[model samples]
Target: MAHYFVGDIQGCFAELQKLLLKVDFNPSKDTLWAVGDLVARGPDSLATLRFFQSLGDTGKVVLGNHDMHLLALHGKLKRNKPSDNLTPLLNAPDIESLISWLRLQPLMRELPEHNVIMTHAGVPPQWSLETLRQESQLVSQALQQADYLDALISKMYSDTAERWEPNAIGINRLRFCINALTRMRYLFVDGHLDFDCKQPPENCTNPQLRPWFDFASPLRESHTLVFGHWAALMGKVNSPKLKALDTGCCWGEYLTLWHLESDQKITQKRLKKS
Candidate 1:
């Protein structure tokens, strides 16, 4: 049973299917790890959500920013962007079941045998592995609670990067956790999140800002991190310790799958966006 980690799908269901077929994946045996964005900015959002949701026992997804947005809107926790196109998921025949299943997915997974940690985006430089584990559970608890709407509200706000003081578990703390898990890409010199920088490291004027995986990164000892948020950085950043899978598939780049064990690369069949 091979484990294949695929890139951001972004509603391209056909491409995903072709890529899985190329690897000869069997639902009963092989495991597929998705670097989220399972729905958004493409034509088949509903179909994509349904397909991944149906994977049930075989699939795993680390929630992306867009995926969190879908969850927020799906649960009525936030307003949708005018450019956001999630009508298909909202109107799907099994939308409720799909959303419930999606809510159960963990924000981070550490495969000890593989020594790779998976999250929708990079882990915060300040967090220790133990802290991440504790907070992930706290976030999961918040997600599973009666006031889940409140939790989702806190989870979607990425602008707040306040430090975790004491046992921080309130709304602001939740926002910090969500941003670290889903929207983080760069860090300010003070190690605070620089959430506004979307440009590559080379172009950014803020010398204070640094990509999440700079080899000497503060969190390097935690685990081999696998993340996918910076489509601007493209695939397989040189931080050899870090593995990025978002091959910009939604932007006409080929979707990619990297086998964790052998480091073999697989590309999905492309259907050019017109």
Candidate 2:
């Protein structure tokens, strides 16, 4: 069975299907993994969510910032914006089941057999893999519990905590973890998360900032880290251990699909307007 890791789908269902067809993907014999942002921005969010939900065990996804935003909208913690392109999904009869399935997905997923770990964003330099796993589980547990889900979603929207604190508790802790796992891109030299910059590393003019993967983390040495949140990256990073898969298919660019074992990259361009 082959493992295919795809970039942020972001409701680009037509492109995703085309990519799968390029690989002749068979769900019965192949596993599909996504770095998240499963819905939003592109057309057909409802169809995209339903398709992934139907994949069941063969498909795996981590939550992205968009996915969390979707949850917050569902829980009435946030209002939906028209630009999100999610109204169809929100009005779907199976919305509850789809959201529930999404909530149950972890923020970080580890594949020990492949010595790989994936999150929506890249790993933080300060976090050991074990700490990352534990913190991610904390958020996942809260999200899975109906009683605490709304409260957790309500507090998840801030960027105030830039650095990690071992003693951080309650909402502060959950917010920090969520930001690090799903929204992180750059870090200040001292290892604090930077929220403002989204430019490619070469174009970044800020001296204090560096891409998260540029930091010296044990995670880089221990496992192949795959992530997809930064579409501006256009699937490029310096290190062999780090893979940036988001190719901005929703932005009229191409979709990227990585064949994990062979390290082969397959891409499909966005469909042209008829």
Candidate 3:
């Protein structure tokens, strides 16, 4: 009954299967926590979604930027460029069901037993676990409402602000929460999100910007924070309490999964270049 936290799968179903086999994943006993980007930029988005969905309650997921983009595209009938590689998924007979299932997934998940919080991008240093939970609830509620879901998704594309303000309201606030939980990477000294820097810490050109977890309290409310999304990190962060699992499987890199109890990493290389 082990728990495995996997990095961004990004539609690489074959690699995901291989990694699961390596871990000896037993859906009946083992729990799989995915860091999102489950579909897009790989060979088989449809198969990837189906396989994860098959896991049912055993598989937990957070929505990544790509995942939300897919939902937005489907919900709004927006023009999708060919490069996204989502057409096959869009054309599937059960596309609506798939999208609905994805929309219902939360942006963050807390494993009480492990004292761990999981999200696509790392949580902002400014937000507490309670704040993360409350904001996630707001987004989840909006996504569940059919009439307003599309509108919310449509508003997701707006530019993000530098920092969070507790007083902020409406769609702007929702977008801020989404951006922080799913798209954030670097941050300015004042704890504002820095959208431009994606390079690893060693190569970062600007001294003022810091990785999101740099300011993390080693443990957030005594819980470990596990996240993906920054493949440039290659599963490395300075804090023992912070775990970065994205190894850029879609970019022909490794797919990493962390065993929760022992903190062992089980990784698999990409089956082929996308």
Number of the top-ranking candidate, with TM-score as the measure: 2
Kindly list the per-residue Cα lDDT of model 2 for residues 115-169, writing each as its tens digit: 9998999889888989999999999989988775557887777889778999999
lDDT of 1 by residue, 197-226 (tens): 888777889888887676254457646788
Give TM-scores for every candidate, taking all chains together and pairing residue i with residue i. 0.92, 0.98, 0.96
Question: Please, what are the lDDT tens digits per residue for candidate 3 over residues 30-75?
Answer: 9999998998888898998998888899999999999998987787
**Residue 23 lDDT in candidate 2:** 95
User: What is the C-alpha local distance difference test score of candidate 2?
Assistant: 0.91
Model 2 steric clash pairs = none
Worst 10 residues of 3 by lDDT: 212-221
Better of 1 and 3 by lDDT: 3
Q: List the residue pairs that clash in candidate 3.
A: none
The TM-score measured for candidate 1 stands at: 0.92
